[model samples]
Target chain A: MYRYDEHDQRMLDERVRQYRGQTERFLRGELSEAEFRALRLRNGLYVQRLAPMLRIAIPYGMLASRQLRQLAHIARHFDKGYAHFTTRQNVQFNWPRLEEVPDILAELASVQMHSIQTSGNCIRNTTADQFSGVAPDEVEDARPYCELIRQWSTFHPEFNYLPRKFKIAVCGSVADRAVVRVHDIGLVIVRDAGGATGFEVIVGGGLGRTPMIGTTIREFLPAPELLGYLEAILRVYNQFGRRDHLFKSRIKILVKALGADEFRARVEREWETTRRTVPPLTAAQIERARSYFTAPPYEDIDAAACAGALAAARATSRAFDRWLQRNVGAHRVPGYAIVTLSLKRTGIAPGDVTDRQLELVADLADAYSFGEVRVTHEQNLVLADVPQPRLFELWEAVRAAGLATPNIGMLTDIICCPGGDLCSLANAKSIPVAEAIQRRFDDLDYLHDLGDIDLNISGCMNACGHHHVAQIGILGVDKKGEEFYQISLGGNQGTDAALGTILGPSFAQEDMPEVIGRILDLYVAERHGDESFLETYRRIGIEPFRKAVYGASH
Target chain B: MALLIRHGDIVADDWVRLDAEFDTAAPLPPGKLLVPLCLWNARRAELVARDQPVGIWLASSEHPEAIVDALEDIALVAIDFPVFSDGRGYSYARVLRDTWGFAGELRAIGDVQRDQIFLMKRCGFDSFQIRADRDPTDALAGLEEFSLVYQSATVDPLPPLLQREVRRGA
Candidate 1:
């Protein structure tokens, strides 16, 4: 993890003081509600349906054990003893009072964290692949670049009030775990023929009311010119992006209205001028950032001996074998394995973690992995470098904590949002729907057989849950004051990202489980060989699934 | 009276802002006048020939190119923010300063509140016409909101990382 220096700490302290003054002014009626909304939102405080929700930024989803413990403390003292991890890899406390938010921010600042740009119309917290430095298929470590971007975008004077909120994602691995294609700006670390690492810059990709796959504006942007290029894009957007209507504001709509070619030309022209005014990133800075993310010290273990011990454990416990197959991932190191502690246990909200669970995860991080944890975009915590020999002991401890659900990519591991139950923007409640679906697919063997289904649910078209890019997407719609779910098929968030097509009329809340069952039954019947749900859906297309769900009369 | 902050001081403002379109039926006002961009476009020669110094005020939607060639005669460039959140003026200020090299007074007008002064300063605005109801003295404190900034702007053109390194070296 990148440790904050005194400069960073000072900035956070100053921000806290500023926010506290703003909050006091609002309380004293010196500031109007509309005036205070912008200030509070920039600090990631949202007035929800029930109470104010405070979103704390976990920059690029990296948390040290001490920071995790601090989060648990905040959850216990300031909030409702639980926190919801969002799809963007940030965490939200749902019941914080507006008056206490500045204090919460002050606490977070103590741990080298603050919620600047986590919301509001600005460059938001830039996200990256959670498996950045430790993944086996990585071309380069993305954390260094992510840290560089984090510093550059924080409190950026020029882009503080963009036309709409902007999201930037970076991916360094062969696998697109960060869902880079559906962000406002996506940077994929790529190598040129000369083996020089640069970026494939994709702009204007987002999932909202209008979902879009980002177009590659620049095929290859040198790493040194990243911030300059970013500034150019933001400058063009700030000057020309639509402000007449809120829905027509995002950079995606601007890119769509002008077409990608003209947008690229404008950006290139702007870059030609803007790049000269800004200083380029230095080699020493890059090296300094990279130094923070170098591999942690690992004990040398005999590979064959460790393998034999793991085989004996797996042979003894079928439960351990199932967990190893589902929750554990292959790490780059010889004796280490990546462990994902599932937050998607049944009966709870998909991403909610109790304060106790938070402290337990912190302890687990200290015990099993290094004193670090990574929050995945799929709403799970990963111990990226757990040794193979300690897997069984870690599993038992995690299972006792009810986090070992063993459903990493299965149907029950649904990516959902805190919907109308908490969000004022949502049209319907999403947690009940996610819970209903989780209960319906409780059978482990059945879930494994279904295999690798990205079931995502959103409360509305805002697509906070990334419902647009799931294999099975359920979006809650408001139909004549009634809550209805509109199901879609064939959406994916992988390298080849695609939007799901709507499947006829939405079903009632009670019929959701049956509808999902019908879709899965059709998939199982139609699957060929070892075809996963996505492959089978693509092979057969949405026509058969639509017919299976809505019947073929129309 | 509307308060005007110039170079971190609340000074007497002699520049009069003309919000309405130019009327051929009426004579122009005396002293320095800041006319709207459209009015500047319509009567460019007339304004240039006048004895009083004239500046141009741009709406949030207006770009800096309209006044790039007109910078020689202009002593002030005023960018408007119809609302505090409409941020096009920040970019316009950068372009006016960094690209076209406008060396005169750059002012931010309309909805210029205390909270926005530091950023406006960074974007090359040396003068701020604070919102009519707000106190200019309180707004002046906004210039010191933070002693450090993280990105390159007109105030400090070096990359922040390099700036940090330079500070450490110093």
Candidate 2:
């Protein structure tokens, strides 16, 4: 993890003081409610139904063990003993007083973290793949670039008050784990014919009321020119993106209205003038940033120990065997395995990690791994660089701590947002819906049999949960304050991106789990031996699932 | 009454602004003319040399390096704020005064706000065109919003750490 320098530390300290003053003024009634709303949101403070919620940024989902311990401390003292990890790789506390938010921020700043730009219509936290540096197929680390973008976008003058919120994701691997295609700006790190690594830039992709796959505006933009090209795109969007309707204010709508060719032409014209004129990225600057992300020191260990781990998996515990098969991945170095801590325990909330659990994760990271942990966009935790010999022992500790569950890609695994229960914008409560689905499918073997099905839910039209990209998506709508659920199928978040089709009209809350059960049943009947649920659905289409769900007589 | 310049407005100020209708080969005017930030391209370089100006009013949207080559010749470089909240002009003003060795009077025009006056002044902007509707007195208060800023600017080249140490010693 990158350590904060003196300058970085001072900036965060000053920001905390600034926010403290702002919060005091708001509480004193000197600032109007409307005025305070924007300011508080910029600091990631939200007035929820039960209490105020504070969201802390986990930039690019990277965390040092010390930072994790700080987060755990905050949860223990300030919040309700728990924090929910979000789809954007952020963590949110469901309860905090407005008066104490400054104290929370003060604690966060001590660890080089703050909640700036976590909310409001600003450039948000830039996200990337969880297995960024360690993945064997990765072209480059991609974290240093994410950090650079983070610094550039933080408190940016022209872009601070954009028409709507903007999201950017970078992917360095071939598998697209970051879901790059569904971001406002997606940069896929690629190597050119001459073997120089740069970016293939995609623009205007997002999911809200209107979901879109970003179009490639520039191919093979040299690494040095990345900032300049990004400036051009943001300049164009800020100048022309609509501000009249909040729902239609995203850059995607502007790209759609202008047509891709005209948008591309405008951006090109802007880039042609600015590319040479903007400040050139110096080699020294890149090196300074890259030094923070150099590979960790490793000792060459015996490959024979991995075979012992496999034997341990097969000997006693069927659960451990399943977990080792699904959640464990190969490391670039021998004798090490990347361990994904599954948050999807059946009948519990998807990404909610309690304060005690946070401390446990931190301790585990410090003891077993390289003192580093990563939060995934799928809302799970990762302990990278764990040695193979310690896998069984680590599994025992994690299971006892309630961190080990062998449902990494199973049906019980869900990606969800704090919908109507916490968000003022949501129309229905998403937690209960996620819980109901989990409870109905509590059988781990059944979920494993179903295999690799993505289930996502959003509380409202904003789609903050990324429900639009799930293989099985659930959207909550309100009819006169009565919660109703809507289901969509065949959506995907992989390289070949496709939006799901709506199955039919909305269903009552009680029917949701049954509808999902029928859909799973259809998949089980129609699928070939090795086909994943998405593949089965893609081949057979939504008609079979629709028939099983709504056809009746089943 | 304050006159607002739209996208296609023609101006008679000393600095001539070049737009889509601009002719590159035209002879030099008698005095300086304000030019749009985009006029620094190769096609307009010949015309720029012929009409060496007292200053140019650069748009905030313009790239800073566009006008860097003419820094030696230009006298008073005026940059537009475009909107009160827009901040690109602050960085441009900083680069012009500090990095490019521009010693001319730096003026800020259009959408200038009272809240932004202090930051603008710290970034090397000395002159301001207060918007007609807003009270200049109120706009001046913008320069006093914060008792101190942590980060260094063109006015205070020392970063926060050094400044804090100096203050402690004092």
> Judged by DockQ cut-offs, is candidate 1 incorrect, acceptable, medium or high?
medium
Task: Please list, in the order the candidates appear, how each scores on TM-score for chain B only.
Answer: 0.90, 0.67
DockQ score of the complex predicted as candidate 1: 0.52
**Could you tally the backbone clashes for each prediction?**
0, 10
Against the reference, the lDDT scores of all candidates come to 0.90, 0.78
Candidate 1, residues A1-554: lDDT per residue as tens digits?
A: 78877778888899999889999999999899999999999989999899998888888889999988998999999987999899998999999999898889889999998889999999999899998888999999988899889888888888999999999999998989899999999999998999888999999999989999999998888898998999999999999999889999999999999999999999998898778887777787777777788789999977789999999999999889989999999988898999999999989998899999999999999998889999988999999999999999999999999999999988989999899899999988899999999998899999987889999999999999899899999999999999999998889997999999888889899999999999999999999988999999888888898788878874
DockQ of each: 0.52, 0.08
Off by over 4 Å in 2: A28-30, A552-554, B1-170
Identify the leading candidate in terms of lDDT: 1
Among all windows of 10 consecutive residues in model 1 chain A, the one with the lowest summed lDDT is A278-287
TM-scores for every predicted model: 0.98, 0.82
Off by over 4 Å in 1: B159-170
Per-residue lDDT of model 2, residues A1-554, tens digit only:
66766677777887787788778877887556865787788778888887888888899999999988998899889987888999998999888888999999999999899999898777888999999888888888889788778866776544655678889999988878898888989999999999987999999899999999999887898887877688678767776777668889889998999998999898887676456544445565566667788778777779896687578676888988888877888887788889999898765688998878988999999988889999998889999889888888899999998778887867767888889877888999898998899999988788788879889999997887788899999999999979998998988896888788999889888999998988888888888998999989889888777668778642
